[model samples]
Target chain A: MIVSGSGLVEALRAGRFVVTAELGPPRGADTDVVRKKGRALRGWVDAVNITDNQGGFVRLSSLAGSLVLLDEGVDPVMQLTARDRNRIALQSDLVSAAALGVRNVLLLSGDHPSYGDHPDAKPVFDLDSTQMVWTARNLRDHGQLLSGRSLDPPPDLHIGAVENPFAPPVGFRARRLAKKVRAGAEYVQTQLVFDVGAFAGWMAEVRDLGLHERAHIIAGIGPIVSPQALEHMRTKVPGVHVPDAVATRLLRAGTEGFTEEALRVCAESIHRIRAIEGVSGIHLMAFGREHLIPEIVDRSGLDRSRFDMNACGSRERSADAG
Target chain B: MPPPRAVPTRPALSSRTLYRLHRLLEPNGLYRFVARVVERHAWLRRPFTRTEESVKRKVFGCRMCGQCALPVTGYACPMTCPKQLRNGPCGGVLPDGGCEVYPGERCVWLIAVERAEAGGHAGDLERLHRPIDQRQWGESSWINYWQGRDDGLWTEPGGRATPVDLGLPVLVTGKGDRER
Candidate 1:
């Protein structure tokens, strides 16, 4: 039986570290992908984020995918990147997403059109992610639009953001995250935490500034269980700082047993990440290998007490049983 | 690739022309002199102000946030960018120096890099700069420059201060940070 599970906000507010998964919308109008993925992640993830034209390429709209997940009895966080829309469209979509039962929103400065399938498409970053975050909070807390016009009933959204612990001028990342917290981000998922030591240093500053109390810091992880995945992320993904030592570990895992080693490596990172004081939870990207998450989560044993999986009334519905 | 759109070159004498008239006027005391001359007479200042708006709107996508940084930005207005980004290019900048929004034309950041290179002031441009103060919106930035209402640098309208006394904490700008 399907039932409305629990809100991520409740989990975080109650001091339960939360887990969220990202689902990239299909390139075409195939609702099957959304349905299949949504059902798979139903109970296991606290929330599922429907990516909006991620990488600045055209895809099935995030709104459509979000609705699909919502129907599957799994809550969704609509990821809105400010690459193709101006403030007006952004505000409109925010309202629409909330109206459609989306309780969470993740703001992003999307990839350039050149990075996606349609390099010829015009990009619009009318409000960068910071401004977008501020604007979203304004709509939620201030009950107004970018033009300062009032909304009769504002949309309710729990805002989240992304951070890269190793971006250049590393000293200011904590400050930047602080600014985002002040702007309206209630939670932050760092760019994949490949280097646990580096991430711990970044976390030290976050704790120093007392931002962890204000924003739930979720560490990002994905099983790059292959030598090819390691090479691709290190070379292709921007702002992802994969140290040579981590890459070499994966390469030495051997091709036949690489998947197991990769899963172990991810689990090890999770094991190490859970030891960090300020971290609230973990975000598993798990692009093509969603099936590995259950075992990985069980193996890591970080925040394994989210909800019960048997009953929906007194007990929590199964996160994977949908 | 789409054919590049014609970006507006600054007028020969406007505040945005020479490295945005920021550094040039800053060191030479030209900013104070020009500001005083405008404040000297509303009659004289009004017409000159009208011309700056009309001309700048065409040549530079001037949002007139009261802070000018042409000298720092290679004289290409950050306001023209679809994102209106202040610190630097959002990760979306095309490899060809074309804008992510208008791929047919060069991004303002590309132009800023070229100008900064030409002026040899790239190192100095990364200093802690403030976000725009909305009070000066739609006003003449050249006048604001003289009045001292720069990005988050002023306390109120028509305010000026010593750089050492900005009071606001420093925040570094990132190259790939999309929220600049």
Candidate 2:
């Protein structure tokens, strides 16, 4: 059933298990990179997330990418990071994104610049991610900016935030989500879940706190692609926890059969994560391997017939009718 | 008792003692007297600020944001975080509780959560801490706390269901207010 506004929000609201995927805009001005990825993800996922300078590297803006995705009939969850922009720029971009018919937004603190390509760049974390979440919520719900200036037409947004359940202070991770929910995060996407057991442990705490009922908790998953990528994420990526057993399994698959084994691992994770209560959906992060998502989703045993691509496009014309 | 020294060489008081001391100084009258004395006695202010800074710097690696979050954060200083996050751990924290930016160092929030849970102040992590008061940087947080300068630092009332007031100008609800 096609909704008048954000299909991702509508799907989650309707209690349909949602699926979202990431799309990193290319470093150059080329629109084709975003479009090609968007086209590939259109029917398979409910919404595509356009990253905001992902990894702190300079790239085509997530705002521009979201616009391109809109042209491709895919709903875009435009990510807005607090790492680069202060309150003014952040709010300005948010208003502009809404006026241009961008519906979903994911607020993040972003990777510190040191982690990105430009290690020398001065980091601008004027507002932490939680504050950004609260700021966006106020703009959408109260029709006011952080400065208390009234917005004639406040940006209508489905506010979201990111969390890493496998990170340290795992016990406090769920409470952090609770704070975001209190700050008006309607949905949350987690850090990559290579360790399903640990992710489930965090979800159990989330359920204990009844946070799942308050906010849509979407588990993050990704196609490992290669043992090299697996090792990179295991050792290098912050917040990602890959159990040694999974590493052993993937490494044992060897180079020739690695692709098949990696996809199988991701698909199995999705299957296991689906059974965990409070998992409203999954956010697929198949970075640079967008083509693998459809097969991974199919392998996860999700009822693909229920994923109606026609109903999932951004419906801008009828968006404000509500 | 100090929760296994975050930096082994650093010396400090136990978090429980600090928490108790913090609670003791929270009453307005006690801190207000100190604030007034520090304000009136210019000669003494420098020594007072210096002593507080040097002591806290050694104990907590405090960056002296002039609004200490130590009590709420289980004595772990959020200002020391590479990103200086006051709310909670960011998504980039390493799996082993390492800082995302400084891979070798432990993420402060992880230590904070563990210490907070151990110290029986786990509920404070859920509070929506306000952004740093930039004007207070380098000043003594004790004086700021005593003068009630940091009283409004929380976006919402702690442990309450009050409506959020970020200290912004009040929202103009009516059409008449909008016209003005």
DockQ of 1: 0.11
Report the first chain's TM-score for all candidates. Answer: 0.93, 0.94
- Model 1 TM-score, all chains together: 0.72
- Estimated TM-score per prediction? 0.72, 0.89
Model 2 agreement with the true structure over B1-180: per-residue lDDT tens digits = 111212311126677788878877784886799788986787988899889988888888866678877777888887777676778888887766667777777887877887787898877777887666565777788887888777666644234212445424333343221100
Runs in model 2 deviating more than 4 A are A1-6, A306-322, B1-11, B40-47, B155-162, B167-180
Residue-level lDDT of model 2, residues A217-304, one tens digit each, is 9989997889789878877677688888888888899998888998999889988888899889999998879899899888987765
Model number with the top lDDT: 2
| Tens digits of per-residue lDDT for model 1, B2-54 | 21332423333433356544445562367677777886798877887777777
Among residues 3 or more apart in sequence or in different chains, the pairs in candidate 1 whose N, CA or C atoms overlap within 3 Å are: A43-A319, A44-A319, A123-B101, B19-B70, B19-B71, B20-B70, B20-B71
Q: In candidate 1, what are the lDDT values of residues A44-65, reduced to their tens digit?
A: 7777788888877688999899
